[model samples]
Target: MSPTEPIYIADETVRALIDEQFPELAGRELGRRYTLEDQFAMRIGDDYGAIFPRLPGRDEHYARVVDLITPHVDRWTFPSSHPIATGVPGHGFPYHWTLVQWISASTAGFVPLHAESARPLGEALREVHTPSPADAPLNPRTGLGLPELEDQFSSLLAFACDRGAPENRSIDADAARAIYEEGEAASQDVSFTWTHGRLEPRAILSDQGAFAGILLWHNFGAGDPAADLGYAANLLSRDMHPHFWAGYGDVSEATAARARAFQVFAALRHIQIDDPFLMRMAWERLMELGLVHEA
Candidate 1:
């Protein structure tokens, strides 16, 4: 990275973490991604790579997620986990940092993604959705059931309306409401399972159109398995859905219904957060699902 480049963590901080944790790799080179905010990946003299992302909370939970994934990804050749969310207490350096063998300097973001990657990504995510053990971290937020999700959506819509729902031709307020309500109605007594809670497109990686690796283990937990699919619904094109689901395994009509409901829920979240790109995709999905008016 250029000296002029803006960084989430200063070079000295990143260097200090490396020196303190894995001193052998200290003073190599530090590079930060322009597109990925608050994250950095370093080249450990080739064949080895590690990333330190700023995961601010849930340190104990994050550790478990990485532990669960370590065995699963062994065959995939992912980095071994040497994660350190912060320096040892009283060491004075308080920041989040984790070290794992970098999968490859060239990740999925290096190139334009294609539909073919959807299936592999589906299968990979399916592997991640395996049943969580009894001791698994059950964060209240992600472990939320239908009622919690409903309340969240209601609050989001109410907040938006309070702000005058801001004018935007891209999203129809009535349509947004319809989709949100429809999602809530469909989410009756839904079961929960292991899920990658925040599997947005950026969290996935690929190389030359093949599934490279998955990133960010902080959000993996026992919750709605449909959560990631909901994210995918708003993030991917309609044409890719079939291929993506094909790799995710057979979905019963009931599961499909729940997935659609979650998708609507996810869309409203995009709008609530004011993420333009996802908001655009979510609105398109709302229209395609007939949750929104044809206009």
Candidate 2:
């Protein structure tokens, strides 16, 4: 299949795959599909869920990511849905898929965690930011420091100003540029650590304002820990900052600056997405951070 073409696996095909490879799971209820850019997932009965890659090789990539992070799962205060079973390609399904323990919790995007919830999140992040092995996966976009990502950030920033921002919303390009430059300056002493590359609102699972579990390990790798910290910090309310920093422990001023810069870049990148909720959320985050103001 062409890489650009969207892969489709119908409900019948998933059912057949379940029956063929996971006979024990047969006849269980299948829930609605949740789609993302690189993969999609559906609830398989009450106890499990299945994730299928939308692009070729993503399944294998995810498998590798799972393997790398599994050892640390026990150390984390929060739970994660690593794969319990791997499904082979069959019945016209072109890539491998996985079955995982279904987590019954709301996501931060929906629940909007309360101030107290930031502590566990900070503690979890502190654990996750441990030094990684030499062979740890590195996603350039999320792993590299702002200096390395300048070109991409520039492109996205231009795109946001030109077409992505909401109507009548004008991003202070000069201020954005200044912040990016400051972040770049602060990111000079880069330290590599395990990072949840896309630690955003949707990836964070919560229960009634409490931190519950983390979802999606596809982007788990080694990078500047600030990227993850910045992304989460941006999602949080300003009042929660003290609690978060207390749990995560002391952070250098440079690291904090880089985190802010990364959040700006992430906001720009998210603006390019077609999802209304994501676009609005990213834009609002940017505004809240002082990158945007009244027209």
Candidate 3:
């Protein structure tokens, strides 16, 4: 991480945190460090990894995402990084933190677009999708309700038109809108299930090319599972998607429709921000997602 980042905390201070709150596990070597939009994470000791999140919003339940997901899919994900005893913010650490079992350097990145890895990715998703309690924490994505999602989709379509790029210019806005409408209608009746909301490839961890543990529970909540799969559908190759769904068990028509809808919006996100690289990826991902078709 750049020293320029304000969230950068010294290793010694982290060690101080360990000595103070988790002395038994203190003094372990720090492994790869991660600086993410919401969190700073690093590996420590032979057994534990930890994250300090710049958690947003006033939602009291947001902080408990790890706590909630652990028990539901303990066998599927890395075990919960239970909060160690820490009080009064020692070492100038500014936000709440949590620790879980460290995944070894043996772990590797998950690439769902590849055929061989897609099936395992599906199974990993299934393991954590059990029913969520009625009181499950709210996902911030809920802030982008169906109407907002639709509007964003339309707006991005217009942005595509404005850019006049071949890929963007070729998109059939009416057809894309139809996909979103179908998804909205399909999702209307399904009851909430536990959803990771954000299931991008970067979020899953692998050991020797096999699914080991999944991470990033900050957006977890009780919601539509199709929306979860929808994001995956866009990320994974279309040919490999069957393997993903096969591992995931059943997919009702409604589920499939919602999945397509969710993916359309997910891909459109790149256009909404107008990041050329990401926008191009989004357009390509839509084809892989099967939302775009050859004329």
Number of the top lDDT candidate = 2
Model 1 residue 82 lDDT score: 31
lDDT of each: 0.57, 0.80, 0.64
**Which segments of model 2 are wrong by more than 4 Å?**
56-60, 139-141, 164-167, 188-190
Tens-digit lDDT track of model 2 for 190-217: 5688888877777888798788877776
Weakest 10 consecutive residues of candidate 3 by summed lDDT: 79-88
By TM-score, rank the candidates, best first: 2, 3, 1
Distance (Å) between predicted and true CA of 110, model 3?
Answer: 7.3
Tell me the TM-score of model 3: 0.77
TM-score of each: 0.74, 0.90, 0.77
Tell me the tens digit of each residue's lDDT in model 1 across 1-295.
Answer: 5643334555566567667777777677765443444445654544444455443454455445556555556454332223333333213434344455555524433442478877877777677667676776664334665456777767765554454322332334566565555544564444566666655545566567565666655556677676666766555668888888898887655456656766766666665654455555555666676544322
lDDT of candidate 3 over 168-270, digit per residue (tens) = 3366667778888887876455567777776654566655665555666657777777778887776565677788889888878987887888888877765
| Model 1 CA deviation exceeding 4 Å by range | 1-8, 34-56, 75-92, 105-112, 139-142, 158-192, 208-210, 272-276, 291-295
Candidate 2 is scored at a TM of 0.90
Clashes per model (N, Cα, C within 3 A):
2, 0, 1
